[model samples]
Target: MSAPAGGRRAAAVDPTTTVSRVKAADPRGHWFLLAVGMVLLACALVLNGYVTNVAGETQAPAPATDVSTPELDDVRSGGPVLNLTAGAASSAGPAARTVALTFDDGPDPTWTPQILDVLRRYGAKATFFAVGSKVAQYPDLARRIVAEGHEIGNHTYAHADLTAVSGWRLRLELSLTQKALAGATGLHTTLVRPPYSSTPAAVTLPQWQSLRAVAAEGYLIALTDLDTKDWSQATAARMAKSALPAKGRGAIVMMHDSGGDRSRTVKALDLALRELGRRGYRAVTVTGALGMPSAHQQAGGVERFTGWALNLAQRASGSLTAALSWVLLAAGVLTLARLGLFAALAWMHARRTRRGRRRRGIARWEAPPPVTVIVPAFNEEAGIQATVMSLVQTTYTGELEVIVVDDGSTDATADLAAALGLPNVRVIRQPNGGKPAALNTGIAHARHELLVMVDGDTVFEPATIGHLVRQLADPAVGAVSGNTKVGNRRGMVGRWQHIEYVIGFNLDRRAFELLDCMATVPGAIGAFRRSALVALGGVSVDTLAEDTDLTMALCRSGWRVVYEEKALAWTEAPTSLGQLWKQRYRWCYGTLQAMWKHRRALIERGPFGRRCLGYLALFQVVLPLLAPVVDLMALYNTAVGDPLPVVAVWAGFVVVQALTGWYALRLDGERASALWVLPLQQFVYRQLMYLVVIQSVATAVLGVRLRWHTVRREGTFGGTLPPQAAPQGALAERHPDAAAQP
Candidate 1:
């Protein structure tokens, strides 16, 4: 019944093959998305207080330098305020028995407001050196400082130590602070305070030079004469006592309003102001004490515009961080939930399958049904011979026919397969049509009502067909999916595929069968009833994943599709990354198409819609899309934020996967030692698969049509049974774990 090799070709055309040209996926789309994501993450880091250091300094204080000079002597011996603007050196202080109270690191949402309330109650005016990053975060607080007769001064953009930074850094710090103030309250301050500075006597030679640089920029350095030491969390009485000027001398007292818990500072300020009022000492702003003009001035339009832009950028970054946080949380919860559910369902399925096997022990099929095996191949010469040989060697005690349909291969696939010359094996040569059309041709020519479909690169065990067809004994089952294993697991790529097949595919199948939510009967090995095929009008060529499409169609038609773990087949896996990407890209894209085509099933009353479709939508499409973003966040955290949490999370995820992988291998009768590769899969192989999903989604959304992608096979197990396959004349039950497989 075999047709001659290279028979006359037919002109039948496949609509899916009508695209103008075969194009690989555009690589720029995903790369561009990755770039945008990285940019957003960088902005997030800046606004979240990582780059700006707004969370406050924890480093040790700068040591005092022993070096001295004429300029250092003048600054160290001067009053609390120094003015060296325009090369002029001068010093000033408040009148005797008067105090100029100044607060640093402020405009705090908590203590600043309380400190301001105390000032208002006692009729005292003070100066607050506001951090620029804080002003941008709480503009209203900065404005309130000015509205209540309080003065604002620059504390650098992020409280950076001016003496430790370069000259350009000094300018940037002052400029950024001015801009922040301008944007928040439309005013800039001339008064400046270098962070970590105290009494004028502590001004070292290096500190004096930094002060000179600030003076050249036309800023008056406001140094503290009396230090309250409030930043160290000292007691209120001790701090209040420190603010008292010696011998009724004029002084500038320093305190803090932010940068940790400020409760003591708030009470200390209240106590100090009360004592100052009792002593008949008036508290005034730095400018009022020095008898100089107001330090605040209106900002120009350009400064205001630049400040506004910074504000917008910070706001956007904050919003993005917040959104990603929630998304990460949701993804974590959903992932854990899915893992738990799958494990539980798989266990139940295994239990039920074991029970069934025990009840049917020693029983055999009363009358074995005839079977037809169809192998639709195109340019699969590398493994076609082994595929046909495996089918012809099947030990089924029923009528069997093997059909190898060559869909216009430009290779010697037809010749090699027909050369076998097995009596029951046939070769049908036709013009190139896609896999679905070739499958339909095989179905039309099949003589048996029971049919099995296998790929040209797959080799099956002698008992595979018998185990596969036995599931059809149940009248309600329309199809059965066999277990497909990676045949070449000697390389890293092969090892990764092996783990994925055992964990992601086979484990999922076990659960899907229990829930009646089977989404796919992989093309490698699947069995179907001929009547069911006719009712569904044969396999549809609308999607690239004809196997998935047909399986979903059957589920929607109220037919049960079960998984048969005992029916094992070994298929060649792509050895290289490029070929793997192409194969998965087509799979993911075609699955998307099938899901879209069967969308109406969502509202239809059946498990197919409520369970299977919902599962695919959430776990397959939505979760995979979000995985990249989550992984990027993990990377960002590891690099910038705390890496402990990231490491802990990664370790936990791997532990869960390792446990699951071990269980999957045990159920499939594989060595548990293979789980060693599971961890490595997370770094490179997992990201590659995720990228495939991303590219496929982009292609689908853009309405781009793709030509069939053919993979190059190496004939890893050419024309031979896998080592683990049943021995020469042994029965399937003789396998050690045959009864345990489910």
Candidate 2:
């Protein structure tokens, strides 16, 4: 942690400061987390595609030309089973009065169990071709299929039509399904049935090629003589009739217990089995009816292990997707609710301010009080002259003095301010302490009860100090936040920050003032009662954000901090993406530190906890944390589902933001034309902001103390000051004794 003001060492980890060793970053920590997040996102997308049947074909078109080769003609003239093992083509059929019963696309949790019960009751043996994805999902059902004296076959993972996929996909489909069955049932099957394929006569040229490939891999292709067409939800009688054979010739009948509602399939199976039994036909497994060896072989160790891993991955992906879906819903609702609250409260605050102004004239001091403006400088020579000169040119009708504390600047910051030779401006030199320390040094030397704090890089308007200090006339108001504007908004980055300050910060402040829970009196320009500062122990050096920490302290102490929109100060915004990231990272991390320090206020009886802290937690912390997922979900929807709804939602949100930005700009007397950049902010700028938040939260959680780095100032306000007025009051013409004040 950076050394505190008085050479005091902070503890290794302190809740009050949230600072640990500065070099404690685990190099692989958040990066590893990011990698894991990406992998999980990939898994979610893949599972979404599988469940939604993306890029999958249930069936292929019949061969346009029934062109037949010698091999094809022989297969058509043969029976249901085709074998191309040992580089030889062969075919077979069941014995007389013997039938093979087979189910495809099964092990379904809902229908597979029902079908299994019927088969068991009828004493019928059958073969089940279970899809790999389903087998992983319903592993117990796969096991039940094998344990119930039934045979199992490979149906290919996800039930993709082999003829429609690549060679790698076809192999993957077969291997994954084998692994799945092996893991679930400790058995692998050589019986393979290509999805959407019926009798040999129905096999297309493309399917024959695919079957040859599977046959080369030692799989016996099992085509059906009779396709029950149960998947079409056919009537039970029609499907039962389709299951019957001609002239009691043995045959293979195909049905399904999954892929859709299968009540009719179940009914047809029962009806067919009873009728077959009465007709002196026996129902048996394919291997049984064909008098062949068992198709299921005990699974090898490697296949079982891989299958286990596949099942684990699928389960984890499914669970994560489910959890993310709920979180997305919650984040969406909270975001909309927050927008509604902001709009309503901002309108109410504006209306109340106007009504109060009409009822009683603008609140002002009968005799304006003397005020001291403190500008803390550290290597800020770039804008120090303009900062001090702007203060000297202020049109306040009271005793005014500008104090610039040079906090161990290696540059000529002190020299630049002293070069101004302003009678009322005092330049104080202090050892290199942090911003809070410098502010404290200036406070110790301040000579007036009313004090204004400004950053060294900001310049004030002629009436800024006058408008800012007037809020102190109400004894209950402890501080007033001035409107801070972007001085360098010609670039896209600057314009984005400009929009944020207007729509996000200022709008929130207006509502915060009404709720009595103002969070931060920004350091760019804010006025404070010196008595409140002294009472709260001046500026705290514990957290990085002294402004936020002190303002929150004041709010908890029952002192009101209000926003004064008329008090304007223009400060240079970061010019590039890298600079913006650094600046926002510091702000967000420091805010996290301050919030952590003031967490006890939540349980205290005050609006500080109920309103301020609650708002920050929900909108600032929780919402940003969920933002990436929301974006990912939007992209997923656009890729796999109808994208019109996503686009509509996005457009609606932008419209709402545009309206809010326009109102904010109008309230601050800024051009509505600047609102043109609001929509573009959503694409790049908004993601950067949320990433900064995520990084800050990660740093805080990891207990890594980020060293405070100075942002390189462009001095956009360097030459923009109006002419300094001659020393007005007798008290201002004479240089003040820096050490003479209490």
Candidate 3:
């Protein structure tokens, strides 16, 4: 959209775009649709009033005040519709005393009025689901039913079986009945009951969903347990005896008011209520009967129903406030975190600007100090050589060294490094203590003042190393973190991980940068001052997120961590979901550990932790647990009669991700190929993180630490990232020209 590499810079949107530009460029054309809808709504209201007030013989008479007008939002069922799936909701305890009676498939001329008369005599309230055509024909009867203090729901214009309608037609049946009934009855519906019952065939598709045919409006379908089958003709006495409940406290009595005659249904209604009253049984409306609030209205709402148009407007205000709040919180945190990060970065940048490294001109500082690149390798015979080669080929000239620590490798890691034969490249071997231990070994032996940590498995741009080091030149910066690009991004897991790294890590860091409080300068490709490293006692293997721990330590010690967007490292992503899960679980659990380890910053003056306020705290810590729960809620809400605001909630987060993701891609100079993964990231990567966070929390709460090792297969991405939320693959740094050469 930005006019590619070299064309006229089209009117493109950037990360810093304001709400106005966003609205203008938004592909959904929400505003345009909103305006059209408002006009249509006005027209509809006028027509509805016209149809309701003055439809002589042609239109059905208005329903009686006592007739039940159950809101039939998704009522296009040729067969039974199950609004609520079995076991969709979790229940804590049993109800003490309750009873619910619901009527279905009627508003017939013969039975409806008679049933209402009987109900009035007994002073009992019941729910009536009337058909559209029936109501249209017997307007007076509908009015009489309403007048008797009863609830009404739509049962479609006719009993059009939902099975007959697949897509739009399914939606059409529901929507038409809604508009017609609402107009005819002057009742804005809230409840729906499919002619049949649960996940209707119409709601399974995207197009039918958008048509919002049935479930679009805030409506809950009635979950009926008992069907009286009063539609079948029977002798009045026989029906009365058959329809009356013999046992059980809750029942949805299905009786028809419309269709043929309802003498039997009328008799059944009189006997049922008298029997209920006489037997010390109470007959009440559904809500009263269930003794539960059907709709969960936000505590302090001026209006109960919020349509998509209103939802967007409300979020526009709410998210702006949220974004501003996070910014302020992050900024305040950066202030406390500056002492350690600022001075070194200021001094380094001051040096770079004076030397004129790149032809680039900015308030850059003097060139950076001699930088030592530390590659912690363990049996990495296949890519260690290439990793070091990438470092040796870098253009940064101030001063740099390649320190490869072959941490007790049985393979040829040291041999591979020695073969590259670069003069300044040094190979150090130490007993394997894991990646953090190897990194510490490299840090201890390096002669230079600045240490650049990289992994053996990742490939990097020659300039990426330089760029990372250059960020350290700024005296205000204590450390610089590079971006991790997915190397196997061609596969499914790779593609998903590619999206995670790009969208999650990159976008998050950018926001962190904006706040000047980057918590982690990942070991994947990061540079730090020797004093800073030494001050923190070097990297520790005690935690899974050694890099995260180190970064937090640096910040806690007053170092400003800078995310070097220009520093790009191509690393292998988790090829399998299992490995990905383990990796992510470790990352999440480790972050929690680090956060706990650095809890002082959140309150007292320590780890850059104190910067987070209420919401951010939830987002960082509580949210991991909440995220999976939210997902579960979404699943339950959709599966049950209650659907959560999935589209609204997710699209909001995606909007923010898109803004920062595009920016990170450009900063990292990754091929636009990486951008393709952005969309799928939500469905795949974000969900995966939530699951990982959930597992992490569960693992942590159980007082169990992650195992030191797990099985990791080097393969292409496949099926859904397995549900395992653990670390997936090893990261490797490739030589700058390794992939480019081909």
Candidate 4:
């Protein structure tokens, strides 16, 4: 097959090429996209508050209504009721027989419709103060109010108290309400009602100052002469009595049609309007009763667009907020579930280890069988000598043969191994092939029944081979995963990997062992029976994760794969973030391929297929895919909501993780000082891992096959051998015969 447009062919590309010089298979465009998305989300969050405040301020009950008798006479002389520019108030009408009824906080689904019905029955026209948000929500009701010959007035969007808000907030409240009304019914109003305080005399000095500011915005303040007090009154009769004008004078009676159950208000309106008509008073709209031109007018083009924009924003914010909430909830549940499962399974494994030790009485020592240790090398010249020397000095009682397979290295990997000149070590060179092919070639040339596979960069302990081979004593066991540690863990990134190895990898391995669902045996160090290897057709190169594929194949064929915790091997991990990303991307993508290859196993009956496949699907595939969303939700919460709760939750999780890491380190006999970097790791390293998983999944879904990512080898483990292994200088001293050849 031809190489992908932006990728190199695995077979043709030189394995010695440094990762930094190679163009990454997929560029980091997704990171850019995610950053842009976060920016948009932040903007939306800020706008959400802005719009909400505007809605609240406009929707609050305006404390005053126009009630000046002289203004009513001016309005009767063909002036606008509540003069828009002069900031003058108008009363019900010039004559005592005319009355205007105004309702506030309305366009309610239930009460507003019933109130409209009562008005229609009585042939009355009144002004309804409509909240902007309610109009946005129920546009049809606002239209119905206008269509029935009744006037609609602005009540602000959210009914917020304007007296307590800033000047900008007050303007936003009124303007947004106007836009909402225009959008809903294509009508605008000039009348303004400042929420809370009643008469101009009743308003405080600061409130009066605020009122003047609002007047500067072309709003004519409206105040009520009579308040029905239906919002506070429990009975309809008392509310009606309170709304009646004194001495049959012109009055603007205030009532409400929303914000609460308005049944009493509706009943009071019914009785009060009837009584007013009987008392020779005519009920009409504010403009009609006052003999002034109607303030209601169709919205202009700009106002319509503004209204549409606000409505769209409200809808978008609601949807995104809900989605973020659900994602956060799922992330929390999954995180807790994983932590609980790991802790419980780790405890079980520890108990099992104690019991097994007690039953066996000091492990019942036995000489292990002869083993062939295969070290696959491709452009791994930097660490090949150390790796071979480590295996050559192994203290296993049984015979050991070390075969170094050089898969066409451009460097001196083969020549270096040949120069090693250890008695049991041999170097075999072949044309370039991948790691799987190299391993298969080495397996084909093995001279023993028990086989150990170690990476070209790994340095094993003196008793690592013996510890690994002992696990095969169980006839059902086909492969054993050895404990792999990060040898170059002095840097922050390296230290984070070390913690991950112990807590994330090893702890989970223990749990998988207990569940009999152990997944991958690391390529750095693992052992397998020769017959089992042959039966599985050696290491298959169908997936990027040949180790995982082979292990799963063994499990499917009813062979047990176990973990050997004492078979310690120190391997070099990628030190840079870029290298690490490339390495993990390959691993994740390869694991996905292998999982897909074994998809049928999910339905198969047995612990290997059922439990193991289910575990892989949930933890490896599913959870990693969900992790990015979890992180994004964390960011969203920190951006828009109270960050203290988010911080507390995150800190709590980190603390639990630290505790788990401490326990895992104790189990592995490692130091606890590394736990301090765990929290910091969450910000950068963990996010990188999540992104790798996301990119890998995206690549797989797009059907783009990624080539092998070669990591730079620094040979950091050359002198870091454990005390039980040959001394650091022994490779040079004991191999003086071969050491002189170079």
Pick the TM-score winner: 2
Model 1 per-residue lDDT tens digits across residues 480-582: 9999989888999999999999999999999999888899999999999877776777888889888999999888877889998888888999999999998
Tally clashes: model 4. Answer: 20
lDDT value for candidate 2?
Answer: 0.82
TM-score-superior candidate, 2 or 4:
2
| Model 3 lDDT tens row, 1-742 | 0101223232321212111111111123443654584455433333232223221012222222332212222333322222232323111111222345566666665666667767778778777777654455455665665566667776655465554455565565455555444444445355566664422323333322322345544455554544566666566666655545555444445566655656777777777776667766666666555554432222112221222222233224334434634654454354334322433343343345445435654334365457788898777766665566656665566677888888778877788778766799998877656677787777778888877888877656756766676566566677888877777766777777775676457656655655556777776788887766665566755577788788777676666787765577766566777788777776777777777787677775532565533323556555554444345434433543234455665565555556555654554445556666666765666777766775666666656666544325342222112221111223223233322210
Alpha-carbon runs more than 4 Å astray in model 3: 1-368, 612-617, 636-660, 663-679, 710-742
State the weakest 10-residue window (summed lDDT) of model 4. 733-742
> How well does each candidate superpose onto the true structure, as a TM-score?
0.89, 0.91, 0.50, 0.81
Mind sharing the TM-score for model 4? Answer: 0.81
lDDT of each: 0.83, 0.82, 0.57, 0.76
At residue 470, candidate 2 shows an lDDT of 69
lDDT of 1 at 626: 79
Report the C-alpha lDDT of model 4 over 1-742, residue by residue, as the tens digit. Answer: 1111223222221223221222346646666776787677766655555444522333344445544455334443432234435556442333577677888877789999999888888888888877777777678898899899888777677776777778787788888889888777777887777656454334444555565677788766666666777779469999988878888677777888887889888898899878877888888887776677887877899998888787677658767766867866776777778878887898888788768857873333265568899999998878887788788777677788999989889998899888866788888888777888888888888989889999998887666787788777777778899989888888998999999999989889888888888889999999997777776667887888999998888788777788877777888999999889889999998898888998888887667677777777776777776676666666756865678988999999998898888989988878799898999998999888877887887778766778888898887755334433553543223322221100
User: How good is model 1 by TM-score?
Assistant: 0.89
Better model by TM-score, 1 or 3?
1
Question: Alpha-carbon error at 323 in model 2, in Å?
Answer: 1.8
Collision count for each candidate, in order: 1, 0, 97, 20
